[model samples]
Target: MTSSIVFDPLLPWPLLAVLAVIAALGVLLALWRGLPGWLLRALAAVVLVGALAQPSFQTEDRAPLSDIVLMLVDQSASQTLADRATDTEDAAQALAARIVARPNTELRRVDIGDGEDNTGTLAMAALNAALAEEPRARVAGIFMVSDGRVHDMLQAPDLPAPLHLLHTGRQGDWDRRLIVKSAPAFAILGEPVTLILRVEDDGAAPGDTLSEMRISIDGDTPQSFDVPIGEDIEIPVTLPHGGLNVIQFTLPEAAGELTDRNNTALVQINGVRDRLRVLLVSGEPHAGGRTWRNLLKSDSSVDLVHFTILRPPEKQDGVPVTELSLIAFPTRELFLEKIEDFDLIIFDRYKRRGILPAIYLDNVRNYVEQGGAVLIAAGPDFASADSIYRSPLSAILPAEPTARVIEEAFRPKVTDLGHRHPVTADLLGQETWGRWMRQIEVDPLEGEVVMTGVDDKPLLILDRVGEGRVAMMASDHAWLWSRGFEGGGPQLELLRRLAHWMMKEPELEEEALWAEPTGQTMRIIRRTLGDSVGQVTVTRPDGTEDQVQLEEVAPGRFEAVYEGPEIGLYRLAEGDQSAVVGLGPASPKEFEETIATGDALQPLIDSKRGGVVALQDGLPSIREVRDGRPAAGRGWLGITPRDAFETLDVTKTPLLPAWLVLLLASAMIVGAWLREGRS
Candidate 1:
């Protein structure tokens, strides 16, 4: 229990001050008058004033809350290396047990994990969170168990009590990690691109020499060369193909190294084409030919080779064929000799008019089989008696022409499958887009129907033949959609997506696995036309598979997030789909090739005037040292003692009761005044 005297004045302090001055003046006037009645009046006035000031003795029961000790455990990717995790766990358990055994101390254990993507170990952030949950007065001290590679040092909160770090690793540990100082996402194929690579040796003495580093491309033979201790060197690498190229770089570990996980780094560079070669063969010349030519020629990257058969087998209007147009179409050069050189071939309103021989059609079929793309824009001629389906090229086509054409105006709508396919999906959702008016009707078989026309027949079909892809747009009147006959559409975007898809762009693949690393969290996305995908298997750098089920939020998009356990190249595979993504850096800031040394954390340790005691040397005993005293002694871990005291008893005695003082002073003055008056 505690007690104190509290005053409750009847008047405000300003008013009381005025009253005190007036009473003092009246007493002075009575004393100067030397009258007995005046003295009695003064005493009566003082008694009245004392009664107005209210005062009370307050007492209450109280209990003391226990002091809290924050225990911050680093469980980041670095802590998981080798026996460091075990060390941290054991230290935390021991500290918690000891704190619980104390008489008036409570333990708050906070586990600090890796940051969101791979930012690093956010030790200070965890400390701040733990501090926010507890009372500052109750905080006895803070104990941190970590490798001491904290990234958010600026965010560290003001400690109410002493802070201590129980370092986790041993001294004299060394590490070698591969660091890619600079790398580009997209590089032109066949051109040399410089990649900045740094082979660093951490925890080693300044004079220590680093061994050779190996650089390789796609698991090919590695080139070995020596690198300096702490400098970046430029290495030129050329991509072999116009696709994704995976490059791996590694450094050999020295003796007494902590880990080899950070010794290797993988980079994925997308290769871009120097030129997009396109072959456009027209069976008949019309206004649409100008449209096709303008579209292909508009792109600076596109190299279009357009050929039109103005003189058909039935037309004999030429005075002399050589004089009309002397330049002959190099059918063999395009179809047979350099078929693979062209990325895509478009057949617009073409029929079996014997312009391209059967041998050239055979070559085109072989081109489609060998990863070449082909697009057939059919008109009424596709359904006529002279349809190209009767030619040798029909064998490789996805659908057979019915030889019946419906030339009616109808709105083209996307199919259910098309709503999820990359090429047509979300094309109509844009506010600036318009609708297509006329579409040709055609029955599709053994292919994906992307668009439907009159009578719900397929207007557009896409199919994969062998390694190549083929798309058939049943109508040449698609240009009418662009001309806004009824309403305009996103004609240019549709064509661009179609062309890129045919070229097998990675982002346009029907089934793909893409992962983006922010911090420690990997935002994994799986795209497929299938209803639901199986569990996604993620293989870490250590070759451990973590399988997680995906949740389908949309028709074709499936997503899930995995908190990366470590910082390295993580391979994610969903069914047959696989992608390699880097988590954090080539080496984590904490581990960075894990041979433990006192280098990176030396500044922090020295700032606190702390010493590094190796666990391998001996387990040190804890001691309560005085504040400002040396916190380390021989074979002992010194803990500074705080001068803390508990309230035993509290009491407040008023100088004197206002009533008692008033009565005593009045009686003395009245007796003195009466005696003086009698004298």
Candidate 2:
């Protein structure tokens, strides 16, 4: 309980002040004139002034609130390194017991986990959130039990009290981290991609010397070499394929390092073709020939080299060949000299034309075997004696000509195998496709028949020979789809998929395993032509293995979601297919700097007059300290007691009564007058 005198003036403060001034002036005048009993007159004036300015004795009823101590415990990924987890939990429990035991003190404990999206430990965010839940006046101290590697120091809130850190880990603890200083999201195929990387040793590093760096591309055998620590190393790599490439770098863990998590880094660099060079060999000027030309010309990245045999050797035109307006075919230059330069070769209604000799056709066969792509769009000539099957390419052709061409209109239908093949799988709006006027009949020898026409005859065949791919379309009416005959189908998408699949794009692989990350959970996807895919064996970054059973979501498509406990590379494998995907950022903020220290946060700690005590020494005791003073010592952490209170009720009593004031003023005036008259 507290009591004090408060005044309620009858008039404004300025008016009351003027009245008091006048009364004091009268007393002074009486004294200056040598009036008898001047002190009694001054007393009466003072009593009247006091009565006009009403004063009351005010008292309050208050109950003291307990001082609040906020303790934030770090449960981020970095805390799981070494013995920091044990140290943090033990210190938090100890601090909680001590704060609860203290008289007139409350403990506000908050356990913070890894920040969303591998943002690392947001200690300041956690601390501020915890503070906001408690009364600011009652908050007396703040404590952080962590490894002191806070990522959000700039987010520190206005400190209502001192902040202390119970640092985890040891003084001699060290860590070796692989830093990808620079990496490109996409690199041109066949060009050397330069990567700026650095390997660093932090804290009490073991012997400042070189460390071995291992590099692996697309799950290949790792190649290693000794690289100097704390120095940038530029690694130039030429990608093997034109698709997404997974490149990983690792530094072998040292004996006393903090963690191996930072020792490895995964980077996914997409290998893009600088220019898609396509060789189009047309047999004659045909209506469907421009469809292939138009499709290839649509993409600016594709360089189309169209060679048409407009003038065959058997032409008997009297006009001189040199005076012809059409551009002469450079058969030798394209078929012999620069044939290997093209990524794909398209034969649109092409036959066994005399323009390309048997040797050039043989070279095309060899080209397909040596990682090249070929797409044959057959016309009516394919069912004749002059078919490409009669050339040296017959050895690699997936089907043989039956010398029969069906002229009846028929709608193209995907085979059962085509529904699983990446090239034709899930073709959007395939049911709305129009009919083609003709399809050449053929007998399948090898490869998979993905599409059929009337009488279930093979219309499309896709196969692999050596390291290359071949696609044979038995019909030349695909242009009908592009022209929107009846209702157009997904011609563009189908063409794109077919071209990319022939180019051996990883995404179009019929049998493959891959994953994509959504936050910390990995969506594992398996694509195959088989009925079922076995459980995928996932090898975590920590070298732990887990068998994940996938549920089939669509035909030949299996998927399963795995919530990763750590943010790093997870290698998934199903049978002969395997892939590596990073569940989070390659270098997560959690493991960037795993050493336990407060150097980065010294300014924040100093502003709060806090101290950093290592758990390696011992868990310190709690002590009370005055505000605006240092609150930490070698053996203890100090918390100031706020001594806050709330007023339940307030009572006010008048200090002076009106009757008493009137009586006192009259007596003083009478005495002063009597004294003056007697004198």
Listing every candidate in turn, what is its Cα RMSD in Å to the true structure after a full C-alpha superposition? 7.1, 4.4
Winner by TM-score: 2
lDDT per residue (tens digit) for residues 222-295 in model 2: 99999998889999999887666888888887887888888888888888889989998889988788888898
Clashes of each: 10, 0
Q: Find the candidate with the highest lDDT and give its number.
A: 2
Q: Supply candidate 1's per-residue lDDT for 282.
A: 91
lDDT of candidate model 2 versus the reference: 0.88
> Alpha-carbon error at 10 in model 1, in Å?
6.5
For model 1, residues 1-679, the per-residue Cα lDDT tens digits are 6677776668987887788779778878877977555666566556556545555566645566676778788898777766888888887787678777867667889999978645678887888888888767677666677777777777767666556667777766667667888999989877999999887777753456555878776445789988776787888999976666767787776566777777787787888977899999999987677778888898899999999987777877757875775468788888888888999999999988877888888888889988899999888788888887777778677777776677566767778898778888877644443444445456566678877777778878888989999999887877765576555676777778888889887778788887867655787888888888998898886889999888876668888889988656677887888876766655556555455444555555455344555556545555555545655667765444443445655444443477676776678577757866885
Least lDDT summed over 10 consecutive residues: which range in candidate 1? 429-438
In candidate 1, the residue pairs with backbone N, CA or C atoms under 3 Å apart (3 or more residues apart, or in different chains) clash, namely 115-520, 116-519, 116-520, 116-521, 117-518, 117-519, 117-520, 118-519, 118-520, 383-403
Tell me the lDDT of model 2 at 545. 95
lDDT of 1: 0.74
Superposed Cα RMSD, model 2: 4.4
